[model samples]
Target chain A: MNTTIRILRYGDYDAMQKAGSNIPATNSSNHATSTAPEWPLWEVFVRSKQGLDHKHVGSLHAADAAMAIENARDVYTRRQEGVSIWVVESKYIHASNPDEADSFYEPASDKVYRHPTFYDLPEAIKHM
Target chain B: MSYQPTVSQLIHLADNALILGHRLSEWCGHGPALEQDIALSNIALDYVGAARNWYQLAANQINSLQDKAAFPLNAQGEATEDTLAYLRDAFDFKNFLLLELPNGDWAVTTLRLLLSASYQQLLLQQLSTNEHADVAAIAAKSLKEVTYHVRWSEDWVKRLGDGTDESHQRLQAAYHELWPYIGEFWENKLALPIDIASMQAQWLAKINQVFEASHLPQGVLPTWHQTGGTEGIHTEHLGYILAEMQFLQRAYPNAEW
Candidate 1:
């Protein structure tokens, strides 16, 4: 199955300032001298229970991975929604270029045989 | 020797948790970051929950004592947990001086939490195995939460102490400011299960390890350490805290959600 992921990119500091987004930069040192020291963004994923795959829940900012994990626990798991948390630096996530979307994903859409629905199962194959 | 916590000792324990939890709750909306805001609030909830448990136990003990003594009832004689918490004045509270101080900055707040949680973890660990069943049970339940609090604060201590020049300086300043209050945790004659002196040593050693890892200097015993919160002598901050915290209960007696 093809899953479409939306990547929300925060604009650069200058652009953000021009856009009137009052978000402060994350770097504490820069905070003294500059108005834009936002901490790096991290994408948060949570596993609701044991044996479940981690699903992307939301995003947050932190100084490091350890901080990010703790932050994710605080923000996402407060209501006991997650048994485990995974946080990745947003910059580290690789994605197929949006400009190549047609060439990259269109071919898969035409390959009907690639899907399980295309196959006819025997009546005796109960599990299948 | 088998140790049984007296009513006063139980009240002291409950008061410390209640006051510190109130201080932490002040950070609910004002944290440096959104995630930290939630984290601090969660910690505040844990502390208040622990306080409620301790207060409930204390109230039970108080009520039983009143029953045995046939004590005359005062105008506000109920010994419920809410009465103990909301009706008590600042002079009646027994939290550590360290916990009552304002949240100065992120560095100050983080370091204060680190120091207090370290002591609480050790104290609770000892209490979890106490001879008193109720004390042991409450300590055991709170130990898990305190353990996480220590871990969370310890990481921030290390991160800030070693992160940047400004961070290091800010953390060092916070240490200097907060170090004097650490003595209040050890000084006192509570006929409790654990030996506080030995616990203080362990607390120092753990603090030293974190300081070494973070490249911050170990705190020296100050010439004059602040004291007396455990004895119901508090800094001026406690009154304000009580005023804010008890406002609802004070305004509407027996008000319930």
Candidate 2:
């Protein structure tokens, strides 16, 4: 299956909430009149100063990507762990079906040539 | 001549952070959302952390003062952070009245943070350049935390003010409820080392921008402003806050973690 990534923006919240098809309304009440609609779930990725890749940290709820980044900072990087943050709507994330694992991954099981064990390197290659 | 911060001045700063931090801690498990709960708690921790720094400096100042009779020192033991925070009576607390009032609702809490954080951001910016190394260092560190706080609170205020009719009304009411106490931020009744009144124009300009963005009403400002928190006079609410906060230590003295 092919996965296409779509960037979510702040203005998209109103449209998503208006559609109200699958998104659940939050039961929490902070406003005086009625319960507020639940914020969209966002998956947070944080890049540490020491590392080059943005690693998956955790998920949080926020109204928009801007708020998601701030929430991620407060929740995930409270100890100064991250130098950069990226937040994507959790709904946009695609995962392979667990039931199809045998069909999807079993083909690679017999491919022994993928391993580099056949290569004979000089003994001087210490780091490798 | 370089300006030296007095013990009262440091205590004033400590009291503001400690009271606001305590108020924010009230929403620890009770925030509207789990993420926001953690966010507010993080902010509370930052305020408490800043308060500890100020109180530590204040303690040192109090201990080293040549004339102990000048300022009213209320701690039973050495003027440690714990003693300054827990041992002081309600009358000794110098936090603004806006901080001690109960966090009414999400709107109230958000607006309060926005207002107070705006003033604190300016105050800390000035103090960060102070001649005193400790004061400057603490203010510089706290300014970073407070800059984020102001941003977070400003975002909420705009969201709530422009959100729904219910949200707009609630935020407007919160503004009205919190308006009078805003003036005390400018009043340096305790004669602190920093010039707070000079920052009033900047604070207003910053808040007015938020107000404009949020579509909150700008007219009908309060004529009479509430003051006296700097002089250690506070509303009845501060007493209750002290009673609850001071309970553990008052019940068992010399207790340590």
Per-prediction CA RMSD (Å): 8.3, 9.3
> Residue B181 of model 2: what lDDT?
92
Cα lDDT, all candidates = 0.84, 0.86
Q: What is the C-alpha lDDT profile of model 1 across B109-130, one tens digit per residue?
A: 9899999999899999999998
CAPRI band for model 1: acceptable
Clashing pairs in 2: none
| Cand. 1 TM to true fold | 0.83
Off by over 4 Å in 2: A1-37, A116-128, B66-77, B195-198, B219-222
Model 2 — TM-score against the truth? 0.85
DockQ for each candidate? 0.35, 0.33
lDDT of 1 by residue, A1-128 (tens): 99865443665666767899765435545343231136789999999998889999999988789989999988999898999999999999998899999998898987888779878898988755
